[model samples]
Target: MALCEIVNKIAACGLDCSRCADYENGEIKKLSRRLQGLLKGYERLALIKAKTNPAFEGFKDFQELLNIFAGASCGGCSSQNVKCPIDCHAKTCHKEKKVDFCFQCDEYPCERQFEGKMRERWMERNNRMREIGVERYYEEQSKMPRY
Candidate 1:
């Protein structure tokens, strides 16, 4: 695909879908599967450990993490399955305003639902998108390290 096309995969929330761990690839799914297998294998051991140790209580946290990994796959907001509040709001707002991005709206910096550092990050990203344009923004995002 063309660079611009790839960049256009960025979500309305300013997240580069292309940089998402779950975007197009099955890394998260594979990891989740492996973790599930390991957890299954260690279930008995975990049960024993939990009986004598408080730290093993963290097994619940591990299961939560596993759930996150398992649900990490996404195809961006355009996907029919996407149901994020930010994505839905952005899409609706942009469509109503006939603009391509949130930055184009007069309420660009207005508080919709975001708060604190999250709002700051969103503003910064939207400003950067405006400053650099979508294509270049994606290129810059591509150069940044991924989690």
Candidate 2:
């Protein structure tokens, strides 16, 4: 509710805003709440999974990682650390070479060392936006004024 300065149409994650649930609250809020509950449920499952599944043992430290994402209310990239990937090869390489997104630089798809997880997420968001229509979703979300 604090009229935070949203990017209006773009996320540093390369998302075209209108796709965000926070940006389209009416229809989105229910889903968002559901997702919030799901995330919480996922955390619980992760805890259980961490104990039994060696594959998920990496998630043993899930709490710490989720804490970073918990406060992120789609508050923009620069402002939200949740969007900032930890040890992101893309960001590191970008900084080392002095560039922005990989798409902007010479390397659109660096198979040698690419962020597959992040890339997949980007694709998912993009596809969802395309399906929902950016402005349609935005108008719905805009109803819930930030302040």
Candidate 3:
């Protein structure tokens, strides 16, 4: 992949923004909408079955969860107009350094922006990108799940 494309698809923290479940029109959104369509009349069936099967009582909760997933939508962190809606420090740091990714900066593993499992994942991804280069990293990350 080209540098421009890679920058657009990948986040400064090494996440593949395009593959994220919350990204606009992403796989999870599409799947959730499809599943919602398939279960259009499931509430009625669930209500009828609830009297007999106690497990069916949780239909509303399940539906709520599905609705949340179905509503997932984000413009991605790379969007110039709304970069990193959450105001991630890493994004600001990268812009200041004029680097497209964390791996490109001199302080590659600054350990300032993330914590716990996220910090670990961030380090691992940036290291991998540094070792293999962004193009190959983008190709590899494209095949992986965001969540």
Pick the TM-score winner: 3
For residue 41, give model 3's deviation from the true position in Å: 1.9
TM-score per model over all chains: 0.62, 0.29, 0.79
Give the poorly placed runs of model 1, Cα more than 4 Å off. 1-8, 17-30, 72-74, 85-88, 96-100, 104-119, 142-147
Q: Looking at model 2, which ten-residue stretch has the lowest summed lDDT?
A: 1-10
- The predicted structure with the larger TM-score, 1 or 3, is 3
- Give the per-residue Cα lDDT of candidate 1 at 23: 56
Candidate 3: residue 73 Cα off by (Å): 2.3
Candidate 1 displacement at residue 128 in angstroms? 0.9
Candidate 2: segments with Cα more than 4 A from true spot = 1-87, 112-147
lDDT of 3: 0.80
lDDT of each: 0.67, 0.46, 0.80
| Top-lDDT structure, candidate number | 3
Decoy 1 TM-score against native: 0.62
Candidate 1 total steric clashes = 0
Candidate 1 lDDT for residue 6: 50
lDDT per residue for candidate 2 within 56-76, as digits (tens), equals 766536544444334335533
In candidate 3, stretches whose alpha carbon ends up further than 4 angstroms from where it belongs are 1-3, 80-88
